[model samples]
Target chain A: EPEVTQTPSHQVTQMGQEVILRCVPISNHLYFYWYRQILGQKVEFLVSFYNNEISEKSEIFDDQFSVERPDGSNFTLKIRSTKLEDSAMYFCASSVKGAITEAFFGQGTRLTVV
Target chain B: AQTVTQSQPEMSVQEAETVTLSCTYDTSESNYYLFWYKQPPSRQMILVIRQEAYKQQNATENRFSVNFQKAAKSFSLKISDSQLGDTAMYFCAFMKVMNYGGSQGNLIFGKGTKLSVKP
Candidate 1:
């Protein structure tokens, strides 16, 4: 079955440096999302993208965070300056339809900021 | 806003026994979707099952089934004849249907319940 695919299974970056996480959603999917889970914490929603623009975002998705669909197939999330608290597992997901359709998740990218 | 709650933080079951994980949600929207996702030690999120709020007939996938009570706002997952492979952290999530401009599909997830199956 087709699934969401994320690049760089694991990444370690400096506290003040920038990092980019990339995802390639299923070809036919229309909706995409980004979520993160801190160690021993609940998975928190970051943002959702559709039609090549941000559809919605959470408080956790502040100015430092940005998402782009540079190419038709590639969706990327960029963090301007990483912090120690930013360390977590970031997941990329997509659904064929909107809310009612079941979303499929990628095998997360583990981001470690030191 | 919609919220999903998984009261059980951890649970254990014998290899051949049955286990149930509890989940409750708060949502005013009559049309929505509920899902059960499994994350094993590998930390890969896998969709185990899903149920539509409007469907009265509980959804079942082999040994896995759900008891969805629309009136009580409850959706629970039951695993029968559990196997060691079933050991994982299970999360219950809720999604509200929205078509408003600039606001669309997003999932509100619970804290998750860690389940360990003893051999």
Candidate 2:
């Protein structure tokens, strides 16, 4: 019953500022993913990482967003320049096996850009 | 592009009554998987149920059950004897059958239905 854990449950930042949300995925899970959910909107996929590299990313993950597994246990999403639209709940998910398997999500990081 | 559709934006049911959340997905892939997740006020996404497209039988987990009609592209979740805790935003998701990228399954989520189960 291990779960993915994210830090800074809520964060507020100004426009043009840089922000990094951290996550510690389930220890034994191999695949990691980042998703964003704007207020009253559907959850949107941002990126997925495996084998220490990005396997897939969406258009929303343009130049502003990047993900890295800096260490064995941590997965981080860095936003180079925050925009008003970037405010949302960022969820980190991990699966024992990629897309076909059930992915468990973290409590989520609420990022608010002013 | 694949789309997961949840036509109901809001639904209400009295405690102990049954409620069903409808979902329909558009996917060309013959093999795939469907999932239903619940996000309560805490905003944490919790898995509710899952169904494999290839399976003819519906998948049920305790009070949670799914009516998966592969031909109709429908996967609905039913909460039997709904409880107050069942009030939340429920989302329907789609996952590809093949995960060449490995254990990380990319999911396509629906707009979500805000369900209110009153006591």
Q: What is the interface RMSD of each candidate, in Å?
A: 2.4, 1.8
Q: What is the C-alpha RMSD of each candidate to the true structure, in Å?
A: 1.8, 1.4
Name the regions of candidate 1 deviating beyond 4 angstroms.
Answer: B99-103
DockQ of each: 0.62, 0.72
B36 Cα displacement, candidate 2 (Å): 0.3
lDDT of each: 0.91, 0.91
lDDT of 1: 0.91
Q: Mark the regions of model 2 whose C-alpha exceeds 4 Å error after superposition.
A: B99-104
TM-score of 1: 0.95
Q: For residues B7-64, what per-residue lDDT tens digits would candidate 1 score against the true structure?
A: 9999999999999999999999988888899999988799899998878999999999
Score residue B83 of candidate 1 by CA lDDT. Answer: 99
Task: Give the deviation of candidate 1 from the true structure as CA RMSD.
Answer: 1.8
